[model samples]
Target: MESDYQSLFQVRLANYDDIPAIMNITREAFVKYQQMSGVEKLAALEESYNDVKKDIDTKVVLLALSDGEPVGSVRVEVFPDKTAYLSRFAVKVTSQNNGIGKSIMNLVDKIMVKKGVTQIQLHTGSKITSLIRFYYGRGFYIDSTDKSRGYVRALLIKEYQKKDC
Candidate 1:
């Protein structure tokens, strides 16, 4: 029988108490990318618990849980121009490849739409082939790149357009 991840995982907005787990998961998730890119100082890996709490206070920090343990998380910070900056996306190293990241992205997209956002954007290490493929598969295209910026990341963007009948 196939596993029903929706039934197995709980998705919810994070609280201050969840910051430590969030930080740990984010750090662990980015370690592979760091190793791949030779960028040890990636901001995601250096995020402090307080920094996460600030995000919880200001933006959206969504988490997927398994029996109350945080397994995946992503942050969405909305801007004034109908754009949502999606960042700090991370899934537990052990919980990856199990559709957890997709679940989080789908949920976050819905959340953004409900918040009146028309565009979603994020940055990922350009050297990570899997990430580039995943983002492309999700309908995001490489909007631009600033190699001089942190870690030579790619700025990907996805726009939601309302259908006209």
Candidate 2:
């Protein structure tokens, strides 16, 4: 099943024209987070086109497409210390459980590795067990937790092994 999906799915760096698709997917995906965390408003849900465009200009923004249509998206910014911060990762609700999220993440790892990023970090609601498990399965581990957002948000980190080549 995963392989079948992979054949039809493609991940690519996003461009200016992709802002609309990215925004749509983010809203569709993060609404679930807002509901699960009981947060009435989220930064992801409030982003405007300019905000996404700025991200596209400064960060690594990617879109996951299935048969030429956008279904998922993610953004990551790599810092001077070779650490990257991932944000706005989302797969459409209709496309969940189809291996799209995992595929996007796997591509993220490969892209970061090529960029010499030693670690990648992201935060999510601690109570989202399924999401936590998904991160764990993708080689991420909890580094800490913070309640500054009125709910526990777990900081997860994934470290890449430097190739000896």
Candidate 3:
């Protein structure tokens, strides 16, 4: 069952040693995103090791591993206003559709909720219907769209309910 496959993945906070795996996964995943979105290049693809290192040092960077092999990664920066920005969410091409992405996202939700983040926002190509649907299924809605990057990028927002303590 899917649950069994999902159980194979373990999500944890990333450290300095994870930078290479993180960079590899991001490049491999975003190269596919570029092809799918018909864009020649993406900022994700241009990120250097230093950029990833900076994130690991300053933000909530998570790495998902399967049987001790890196399979996915995501980064989130929680701000002073109780809002969080999610970026570079990518699962390995071989690991896609196996519940790894969902697992990582569910962990993000739990982490954000614990941090009292009421709203989480991310941007993806607006025209990518499958991705849009995925986010929709995860409780995100299109807050707006912008073409500043030469493509219609949708700003998706997900708001969490404050828990009664």
Model 3: per-residue lDDT, tens digit, 22-92? 99999999998888787776999999999999999889999999988999999999999999999999999
Model 3 has an lDDT value of 0.93
Q: What is the lDDT of residue 39 in candidate 2?
A: 74
The alpha-carbon root-mean-square deviation between model 2 and the true structure, to one decimal in Å, is 3.0
Models sorted by lDDT, best on top: 2, 3, 1
Q: Identify the runs in model 2 with alpha carbons over 4 angstroms from their true place.
A: 1-6
Which residue pairs of candidate 1 clash?
none
Q: In model 2, where is the ten-residue run with the lowest total lDDT? A: 1-10
**Model 1, residue 156: what's the lDDT?**
99
lDDT tens digits by residue: candidate 1, 19-49 = 8888888888889778887775777877777
The residue-level lDDT of candidate 1 at 36 comes to 80
Candidate 3 runs further than 4 Å off: 1-6
- lDDT to native, each model: 0.86, 0.94, 0.93
Clashing pairs in 2: none
lDDT score of residue 67 within candidate 1: 71
